[model samples]
Target: MAVGVPELKIERVRQNYLANLVAAIACFLLEAGWYSAFMDTWINGIGRNRQWLENTGINPAIQYGTALVMASIMATAISCVTQLTGKQTALRGIKVGALLWAGFELTTLATEYIFEVRPISLFLVNAGYWFFGMTLMGAIVGGWKKKV
Candidate 1:
């Protein structure tokens, strides 16, 4: 992102909210695919298997809602940063995404895995998803800066 963007405005932030929302959803979907594709590996890493997951039940509503909200917040934060940095471009978004991924996603997962003695594969899968997801998020939020 640039370092000399125009002054921020409420209207502009509001306009970008939609873009952030959409990006978040896309990122979330990417996450779902990533996990699904590597489901067996992930489950095994966490000391589980297909049979366990099939029997274990989670609150779908809470899970989906939490995921959605997390994605939305991430996208919105990226969008805001893109504007503040004065680099409201897809490329800038990618840069921001990488930063966010490293700063937040990678760090968090690494810590969790380290403490839990989780598999490297699990970390790889989770980290990879955030890296790509954040970059794509930046691309979408930064690319769609026309309105803002």
Candidate 2:
């Protein structure tokens, strides 16, 4: 019984880790597609040309890339939390998702600020994206159940 219990615990942890990873990948790809299709084109047309990437100022590529990475991390964290809590509750999921979003938002803002760049407006825009994306991801993950 003791040996079986340890094995079962390890298995559960591994399962949760895998689920989180899958969730991260799915969220990352989805966000990346949206960004590439719309935001990238718009930025390139309005803000700078492709060759401007070689300049030293805040490159839009770095900003978008950072946001994508942050979204993946948030998705993974939400998935792991939902799995560990074992409560497929929407409220719980949203709470976890929101917290993760806030963390990333604040971190990104701080990084931009430290670099002497204007970040409040960008943070606001990214916050909206995070809110919707994470809410959707949380709802789906929280509603998923594993059968014994």
Candidate 3:
């Protein structure tokens, strides 16, 4: 404890692991669909083509594993925030997800896009996916409370 800083007491928020797992799986699936739908646009945005992508030698497992892990982290964060803010509910989770997306994800991506001079279409594709994905995760985490 630093001088003049009051001790902070944080409540233990019980998390539903099942909800987090389900939420992460849902987001992972959403990522697959979203990318598939915007495949051409996304590839073109990065100035690449199918041949280039295939030749990149990146393992699909690594890509998918990363996505799932990220989704899980996001789900847990949403759950924690939702519980901390107020009663955890599907509606509240949705709101938190949207707010977090706009506040953190959107802002950070916008900065990167501006500096990298990336296409607006690419930004929309990526950002749009997160918007929906986060909300979905939030809804699950918020609506499914861990039994105390």
Candidate whose lDDT is highest: 3
Weakest ten-residue segment in model 2 by summed lDDT: 10-19
Clashing pairs in 2: none
Count clashes in each candidate, considering only residues at least 3 apart in sequence or on different chains.
Answer: 4, 0, 0
Between 1 and 2, whose TM-score is larger? 1
In order, what is each prediction's RMSD in angstroms?
A: 5.2, 7.4, 2.9
RMSD of 1: 5.2
Candidate 2: regions farther than 4 A off: 1-22, 33-47, 50-74, 84-86
Task: Please provide, for model 2 over 1-148, each residue's C-alpha lDDT reduced to its tens digit, 9 standing for 90 to 100.
Answer: 6765664453242234444455555666666665555565545434565566546589777876786667566666687776566566666767667766677655765587557654454444455656667766676566554455
Backbone clashes in model 3, listed as residue pairs = none
In terms of lDDT, the poorest run of 10 residues in model 1 is 7-16
Model 1: per-residue lDDT, tens digit, 1-148?
A: 5678887565344347778888999998998898999898889888888898777788777888999998898898888777777758898988888988888888898998899988899888778888999999999999986542
Q: CA shift at 97, candidate 3, in angstroms?
A: 0.6
User: What TM-score fits each model?
Assistant: 0.84, 0.54, 0.92
**Over all chains combined, what TM-score does candidate 2 have?**
0.54
Global lDDT of each candidate: 0.85, 0.61, 0.94
